[model samples]
Target: MPEYNAPLRDLRFVLHEVFDAPGLWARLPALAETVDAATADAILEEAAKVTGGLIAPLNRSGDEEGAQWANGAVSTPRGFRQAYATYIEGGWVGLSGNPQYGGMGMPKMLAVQFEEMLYAAGSSFALYSALSSGACLAIDAHASETLKRTYLPPMYEGRWAGSMCLTEAHAGTDLGIIRTRAEPRADGSYAISGSKIFITGGEQDLTENIIHLVLAKLPDAPAGPKGISLFLVPKIKVGADGSLGERNAVSCGSIEHKMGIKASATCVMNFDGAEGYLIGEENKGLAAMFTMMNYERLSIGIQGIGCAEASYQNAVAYARERIQSRAPGGPQARDKAADPIIVHPDVRRMLLTMKAMTEGGRAFASYVGQQLDLSKFSEDPAEKQAAENLVALLTPIAKAFFTDTGLESTVHGQQVFGGHGYIREWGQEQLVRDVRIAQIYEGTNGIQALDLLGRKVVANGGAALRQFTGEIRAFAAADVPHREALLDAVQRLESTTDWLLQRASENPNEVGAASVEFLHLFGYVAYAWLWSRMARVAASKRAEDEAFYDAKQATADFYFRRLLPRILGLEASIRAGSDPLFGLAAEQF
Candidate 1:
């Protein structure tokens, strides 16, 4: 079985040292009463116990046994039900939920760290609760108070789980083309009739009921996306008095046999005139649903980081114990038959690559989490707007870039393991399979890239990009390690952005053609900025904790020396424009 211990030291460094999260929380009136350094640390410690001691052990067995389907009911792998009960009892699902609705009201910074641990423990298991938290966010943001009072408490208390039902067999990315229909009823509710495919946690035995936030269009609604409406459909109906009623018309027809995350129940749901309460206005469901999607997107991106972190831990442990070939320099361990793989330079390279990317991603996720907290809790108008803008600007990168590098990090970790990595016994291969879905779902990384470069960058005339670069420059003004490298990276990203903008003015497809490469460019530069900050903080504190801070400095150096140069190729590709991409005819291929 694979083992995982949460990086509490690194997490603390990012939270307290790198970001001064306690200070920030104190500054925001809403959070000041709730979280302090001691409380946050205590939460992290308990979370590590749950994640490492409880959930991580179940990952392999869960994947092996998978979820079982019989008739319309789906049962998760063994130990999942008990694990989930323990998990929810800890108030984990409601970590960032509102306090009025049976939640703890913790800041998202803690939630982000907690989410990393949860996903690292088990991706399939994490989805069951993560989806509920996300759906709760949407309902809280846009639903009527009546609906909130009736549904939010049970969902937040973990008596019920939540699922997002948006996709149909006929539609994937194009929600505008979905054929699901909603008919208005005599009272206030609506009758939903449709089939939604690939619904995560759609049907599961872990909870008493599954609440579905479904998207469907009305009869006289417009032809496209604007006509779509959001509905709260439950597997089992609930009364106004918050008591359980009979099973609703909704049922899980079947579950998909998947490539990975086998323990997660991905279901095909059929809603045969299921009674669903309308969420928000009739035609504004997309906007409301985005509340959940945005939350889920970030949560999903962390899935990649968590999986890669698990893989990294496994590979590093194996490298130290497994004696294979001799080191190129000499036999470091003459007592053994062969030197441990840790002495090999190639192995070191792979390990360092994983280290740099994973650490950089952790810091970035924390930074984004801080922004989320600020956007929600800050009273100052300017601060709130600034936080909102950063949230919009970085959400796509957080989702796409983190997962992109996450895959790279995981693959490198597997390479460090060599042949054993490919075997299921080592648990490295399962991580690769699990994280692969992070890139495809929650708006495919490609779509996220386009959203970043096209909508957030070009459509805004690069205002948001300029604001972000300005912040990067403000930080680079400090005398930190590799400051010049970071500045050069920011310049390269800006120039590339300008080039894409000008090209897009002439060729519409330029944005689409260069988006993915452009996103990577932005990602590398953003990490450079973050690593610089971490390096600066680590330098002054090296005396306090030599080993930890020294590792931070070393990883920062490796990232600047090796990984940041990746933008050179991405810039060249972005400047190449869309012309070359269109040369091949559709029929010729």
Candidate 2:
């Protein structure tokens, strides 16, 4: 198995050097006194230590043992409980929760770094808390103050955990057809009766109670999605006095056996007259549920990035140590029978591609985190609205593009290992299987692409897209190394957007057909912009640190020269429109 090390220096580089996150925190009144550069650095260091020393060593072993399901109860792999105990004792679960409820009250920017490290170390262990954080956010944003006081503290203290229960056997992306029912009680709580599938961390021994944010329909409400409502359903119902009461009517029927992240339990939950409390106004559930979904979407996207980082580290280490055929130019290592594989051109191409895309993704994730911070903490109304717009526009792309490229990067890493990658001993195969789910869950990549183009772009008359690309052009105005290349790439995206918008009016299918390609085009351009900004920063600071900055600039150069041109093919595909797609008759197959 491969050893996992936290990318501490690069994480700090993305936070402090590339984005000036500390300066943003200082400017926001809400975060000014909450965190600073020194405090943030200390937090990052400690996060690295916990994840690397404790959690990472369990990745392979946990997969081997997997989560166990017996009768109505589920148990996690060995060491998960102890590791989770140490993890929440550090106040890690509530890192970005509301300060009024015993959370650390840190900005989302810092939480992003910690979450990335957690996923890289052990995805199965990381998911238990990931769902809790998202569920906590939903309850904080919509639940009443009384409910918040009763639920948030114990959850933050790690005595309880949370889950999101939205999917049923019949529904995945479309929620309008769900059959879960919620009946109001005289005590103001509701009785939820239904079953949810694919529930992550639905039942686990790591925490005492599992708080579920469930979606169901009211008996006296209208039909379809408008009638749906959100509820806070707990495994063990909590009394208003802040004490654990009898177990609710919910039970885990079974747990899934899967390809990767086997240590994380995917459950089938049966809620027979389960006690649940209303979250927001009745019949407005979908809107409230999206608040949690958006947060989970970004977190799940980071799962892809974390796996990619682990794969890169493993592949790079092996490339340097694994001996193979001699170099094409000459025998680089005369002392050894065969030269190191790193000396070959094809191997270098694969390694460099992984390096460039993974680092580029790190920068973009931090940038999204910065926007989230601005939208939440900044007092300026215009700045807050701008940040909100960018978040809405970019969140979908982050979920889809990062995972799309993430799968590609992981496959390349596995290919670098040759036949060894196919076996389980090297740990490369686990990463490939684990990262594949990111593209399928939390709204599939296809769903994200549709949301980006259909709702965010074409529906808004390209204003949201222009809002994003305009920022890129503004930054590209600087005299960076790839300034012209980035500007051209942004222009290409703008033109493609215009073409798709015009075609969508004439033929609605154009929107769906052009969506994935359009998103990939936007993703490539966004990375080009970030890579340019990184190259400028690395060049300016090269005098202080030679090797690190030199590597940064070289990777940026490679992204522009080698990877940036791939956007040309995407542009051509988008221009092809939806005619060819509809040519196939429904009965042809």
Candidate 3:
């Protein structure tokens, strides 16, 4: 197994140099006094030490042992409890949470990089806290002040973990048909009776109690998604004084045993007459749940970025050290029997593909994070609206595009290992399995593409997408290398957006049929914009750091030259219309 490093230099480059997070933080009065460049750097360095030294060692072992469910309770793999203790002790759970709730109040831009590191180190362990952070964000935003005071502190302290209960056996993506019931009780509280499946960290040994943000239908509610209501239910009841009371009726019926992330407990939770508190207004659960869902979406996107980073690191290590054949350019390794696999053209191609995609993905995720920070923290109303619009447009793309690229990158990483990648000893195969789930969960990539095209772009009349592309256009117009290529990509995205807007009015399937391709095209263009910006920055800094900046430039060149052309194929496919896709009848298959 390869050792996990945090890639601190790349993280810092994106944060301090590329995005100027410290300057942005200084402008936001909420974060002005709390975080600065030095403090952020120190925090990241400490996080690096913890994840790399402690959490990473258990990744393979935890996967090997998996989470055990002997009785109703679930137990995490060995070393996980101790690692989690250290994690909470470091106050890592509430890294970006509200300060009023014992959170550190870090900006999303900074928090996201740490999240990527965490996922890269150990995804199974990371899921436990990822769900907690998202739940806390939802409670802080939509829950009552009394509820927030009661629930937020312990969660931030890591004494209590959290989970989002949205999926059921019958209703995975379509929550309109869910059968969960939230009936009104005599005392004004509600009894939530439901069974939620695919609940991450729903039943765990690391925390004292599990706080679940559940979705159920009320007795007099309307039909479909509108009738649903969000509820806050806990495994152990808590008194008004925040003391733990008797156990609630919630229990884990069973834990899933399949695919990757075996160490993370995906449970079937049964809430039998369990007490739950309503969140937000009644009959508005879907809107309330999106608060957490959107946060989880971006976090899951970072999971993809994390996996890609880990895979690239391991593959490069293997490529440099594994000697298999002589170089095509005669005797490169004169002292050895054969040259290292790094000398081969195909191997280099795979490695570069991994590098370019991973790095481009890292930049793209950070850009989205920066937009989130601007949306949340900025005081100016217009600026906040603009930032929010961009976030709405880009969130789905980030979630889908990053994970899709991540799976592709991991496969390349696995390919680099050849036979060893297929085996269990090297641990490369586990990465392939673990990352596969990211694309499926947090709203599948197909659903994400629909969300991007149907809801964000077309529903909004392309305003949000235009705002995003406008920013890209301005950046491309700046004095940068490959300006023409960047402009062409942006034009392609704009024209494709127009085509979808026109074609969808005649045939609704046009949106669904063209969404994935449109998203990929947009993703390629977005990366092109970032690459051009980075290349300009690297060129200016080439005199200061010769090799580092040059390598950055070379990678940017590769991204533009090799990877950006994929957009052309995507554009062509999207313009081909939906006739071929939906031409078949229901009985044709």
Candidate 4:
């Protein structure tokens, strides 16, 4: 297996060159003192060592000896417990947590790079810690001060882990129909009675306790989604003195036999009147849950990029080593049977495509991470609001497009390996299976498109769309040599937005019908902006590192000349809206 190295150079380029994250960090009062260029670079270097040297080695073994369920207890694969111990001991679980609560309080922009490395190293192992961090963030933000004090520190230290229980067998996307219930008791706490399926990190031996943020409905609460409430139900309840009490009512019924991420335990949890405390106000669970959901949605997208990076590294290594037919014009390696597979044009195309998409996705994630920071820390209220709106508008696109492209890139990487790719030993097949869940979970890509079209775009009368497009236009107008490609991308986005708005005005079903294509079109345009910015930065830094910089420029050129043209096909499909999608009769089949 090839060793995984964090792309620190690319990360720095995206932060300092593409987004100027240092300037943004300096402007934010909360981050100004803690996160400078030196600090960020040092963090990246350490994260690279931990991920590449320690975590990557366990990936293949983890897959082979996946989490095992004996009786009701879950046991993680070999080396995972030790790796997780190192991860927590290094304070990685709290990289972006509150400083007051024992967290490192790192900015999301910097933490995102660490996240990318974790995913690249071993996504299955990373999932457990990521969920813990995300759940802790939500609790710290919305839960009572008492709850935060009780839970936040331990979770940050990784003495305890966390899980989010939202999905049920019948109520995956439609939470309005969920059957979970929470009954109030004499004390402030409630007894949660429900069964949650597909709960990641729900039950495991890696931690002393598992804190679950579950959604259940109150008996007297209105009805549907409006009646739902969020609860903090721990596996083992903590007494008022901060010591462990009796085990809570929650139990792991069974572990899921998933297609990928086998090392991460996904369980069907049966909460039989589990002792639970409300996180926020009643009937507002969805609103509070969005705090965690939004974070996870973007994190899942990074998971895609991370897996794609891993796949690309392995594929590139394989292509350079595997010998095949000689070059068309001349012999590059006459000592071998023919020449290395890297000399082939078609293999080069596949590798380049993966490179372009993976790098583009990294730049895009960094850009979104910057927006998230600005939204929380900007001094001006208007700037904050604009940042928030941008985050909302682009989040679904980030989640859907990055993961979609990730799966495609991983498949292409697998193709580069030919028959060896299909076998488990090469680890190519695992990357494909693991990346696929990123699209399906955290609200499916189809649901993400619906959210973008119905709630964010059409319902808001294109306010968010206009805000995003304005920035893209301004970037294109700036001094970038790839101005033509940038301008073309901007115009294409404007055209697609106008068509969707006009068609959806008269046709109610048009938005849903065109949602997926619209999202892809938006993603292509967004990636074009990132590619252009990266190309300019790479060109300016050519003297420092010619190979890396040249690679960036080549990929950008490929994205513009080859990949951006796909928007035409999507636009055509969107313009032919609703009719084909909803026109088919019910009994036609």
Candidate 5:
């Protein structure tokens, strides 16, 4: 099995050096009293210890053992139970939750890095906490004050875990057709009866109670998504005094046998007359659930980063030790049978590709996290609105782009290991299998692309896009080496956005046809902008850390030279429109 060492140095470079996270935090009055650079650094160090030491050790073992179901209850892999205990004791579940509710209330900027570390160490183990965090966010945002007071503290403290119940046997993404029903009772609670499938942490042995944020249709509700409502259904009911009552009418039907993240309990949950309380306004469940969906989408995107980071680390270690043919120019190790594989040009290319993608993905995720913090904490209305707009425009891109690159990066890492990568013993194959799901879950990357192009861009008439590109244009105006290239990329993206908007109006089919490539093109340009920013920062700090800063410049150059050009092809394909895509009829297949 491969070992994991937290990318602490690079994380510090991104957090402190590039973003000046401490200064940003100081500016947000909400966080100024509680968090500073020193506190953030200290928190990150402790998080690194927990993830690297406790969680990373269980990754391979968890995948092998997986989660098992007996009778109606699910049990995680052996070490997971213990690791979860430690995770709870560390107060990690509430790392970015509301401080009034017994949470640390850390800013997203710092929490995001810790999140990447968690996924890097153990994604399956991380799901248990991840789902809880999303569910808590939804509850904190929309649930009643009584609900928050009773449930938030315990869930944040990790005494009770949480799950999101939206999918059913017949309904997956189309929640409008869901058969789940919630009938109101005289006591103000509702009787919830639904069967939810693919419910992560639905029935686990780790926590005493499981808080389920379920989506169902009310009796008097209208048709379709308009009628859907959210309810707080607990596995074990909670009484008025905040005491645990008898078990509710909820049970796990079975656990899914999936390709990866095997240790996470993905259950088919059956709720038969289960007691539940309404969360937000009736017929507004989808909106309320979005609070969780948005959070989980970003977290799932980071899962891609986590898996890629692990794969890259292992690939690098293997490349340094495995000997092969001599270098093209000359043998580095004269006395050995052959030089290490790292000396090979092809191998170096693969390593560099992985490095560029993973590091760029990290920066991209951090950029989004910063926007989220700004949206949440900034007092100025204009600043807050701008941040919110950017978040809306970029959320879909971050979710889709990160995962797509994440899967690609993992594959590249596996390729560096050759045939050994396909074998189970080396662990590279597992990384590939695990990272694949990130692209498919919490709304598939395809959905994300459509959301970006159709809803976010087209619906807003490109206002958010213009706002984002304006920032990039201003940054490119700075005295950076790649100023011209950066400015050119911004222009290309702006032109492409205009083309998409114009053509989409003429032919609605063009939107779906062009969305995936459009998102990818946008992603490439965004990463280029971020890399340019990092390069500028690195150049200024070259005197302080020569090797690190030099490496940053080299990677930025590699990305600009090799990867950023991908947007060219993407733009071409998008401009071709939907004619070829729709030419093949349904019967053709």
Candidate 6:
């Protein structure tokens, strides 16, 4: 198995050049004092060391060992406990937590890069961190002040971890179908009774206690998603004095044996009359859960980016070393039996495709990160509103597009490895398996597509799309050297959006059928804008290092010339409408 290394140069470029993250952070009073350029660089450097040195080594072994279950107890692979200890001891779990709760309170923009590195090193290991942060974000945003005071500090300090219990056997995406019930007790708490399947980090030995954010229904609550309520059910109960008390009623019935990310335990949790406290108002669980869902959706997209980077690194290494037939021009390695595979055009195509998508995805993630920061920190109400709207519109795109590209990029990486890619030892197969979940979890990619078209686009009469397109147009209007490519991308995006709006109005099924492709089209154009911005910044720094700038420019050119052209095909598919998808009868087979 190949060792993982963070793409430090690409990360630095995205943070400093593509988005001017430091300048944005400087304007936010909450983050201005702690997250300067030097500090950010230092943090990235340390994160790189931890991820590459500590976590990367465990990727193959964790997959091989997987998680074991015995009599309701789940054990992680060897060194996992120690790695998690290092993670908590280093305070990484709370990198972006509230300062009042013992968190470092770093800006999300800077934290996002760290997140990418973690995912790249080991997707399985990264899940633990993501769940912890997401659960904390939910609790902080909606939980009562007393609950925050009691739970947030310990979670941030990593003395405890968190999990989300949402999916039941019958309820996956459709929360309204859940049968879990929460009976209100006389003491202001509730007794939650139900089972949650596919619960990540539901049971683990890494932390002292696991806090579960569960969704259940009250006896008097309304039906469907609206009737759901959020609860804080800890594995071990805590007293009013903040001391660890008796164990709660929640227990892991068993851990799932998954295809990938075997090291991260997905549990079937049995909440048998678990003592739970409501986090938000009664019958408002789904809305509260969205607080975590929204964060997890973007984080899952980051997971895709992470796995793609891992696959790319390994594939590039293999392509450089594996010798095959002679090059088109001549034998590049005369002493060897044949030229290295890297000399071949097809291999180069695969490698370049992976590089273009991976780099472009990084840039896009940073762009979204900046939007999240602006939404949280900007003082100007209009700026904040715009940022919020863009975040809302782009969230689905970020989640669906990045993961979709991630799977494509990883498969391309595997193709570059030929037979060795299929074998488990090379680690390529693990990348494919681990990335597959990103599309399914945090709401399936199909659902994300529906959200983008139905709710986000047509529901608001294209308000969000128009706002996003306006920003892209502004970027296109800037007098940059890649002005033509930027303008063309903006035009492509506008045309696609207009087409979807018009077509979906005529056919409701069109939105459902065309949603996924439209998202891809949107992603490709957004990435083009990101790459163009990166190229412009790299150009200014060419005097310091010409090769780096040249590589950036080449990748940007590759993205626009080779990758962005796919949008045309997707546009054609969307224009075809729902005929192929919905026209078939259920009994046709």
**Candidate 1: where is the Cα deviation over 4 Å?**
none
Stretches off by above 4 angstroms in model 4 are none
Error of 4 at 45 (Å): 0.9
Over the stretch 1-589, how does candidate 1's per-residue lDDT look in tens digits?
Answer: 6899999999999999999999999999999999999999999999999999999999999999999889999999999999989988988888999999888999999999999998988999999999999999999999999999989898899989999999999998999888989999999789999999999999999999899999999999997889889999998899889999999999999999998999999999999999999999988899999999999999998888888788889889989999998989888999999999999888888989888898899999999999999999999999889999999989999998878878887888778888878989888888888889999998999999999988899999999999999998988786878988999999999988888888899989999999999989998999999999999999999999999899999999999999999999998988888999999999988
| Cα-based TM-score, every candidate | 0.99, 0.99, 0.99, 0.98, 0.99, 0.98
Off by over 4 Å in 5: none
C-alpha RMSD by candidate, in order:
0.7, 0.8, 0.9, 1.2, 0.9, 1.1
lDDT of 4 by residue, 427-540 (tens): 899999989999999999999999998899988888899888888788777788578877887887777778788888898889999999999998998888888888888889
lDDT, candidate 3, 333-355, per-residue tens: 88888888999999988888888
**Poorest lDDT segment (10 consecutive residues) of candidate 4:** 580-589
lDDT of 2 at 128: 95
TM-score of 6: 0.98
lDDT of 2 by residue, 151-219 (tens): 999888888999999999999898888899999999899999999999999999999899999999999
Worst 10 residues of 3 by lDDT: 471-480
Tens-place lDDT per residue, model 5, 483-585, is: 7877888888889889988998899899999999999989988989889989999999999989999999999999899888888899899989899987878
How many clashes does the backbone of model 1 have? Answer: 0
lDDT by candidate, in order shown: 0.92, 0.92, 0.91, 0.90, 0.92, 0.90
User: Of 2 and 6, which scores higher on TM-score?
Assistant: 2
Candidate 1 overall Cα lDDT vs. reference? 0.92
lDDT of 6 by residue, 419-482 (tens): 9999999999989999999999999999999999899998898888888778778877778756
Query: What's the residue-level lDDT of 310 in candidate 1?
Result: 87
Clashes of each: 0, 0, 0, 0, 0, 0
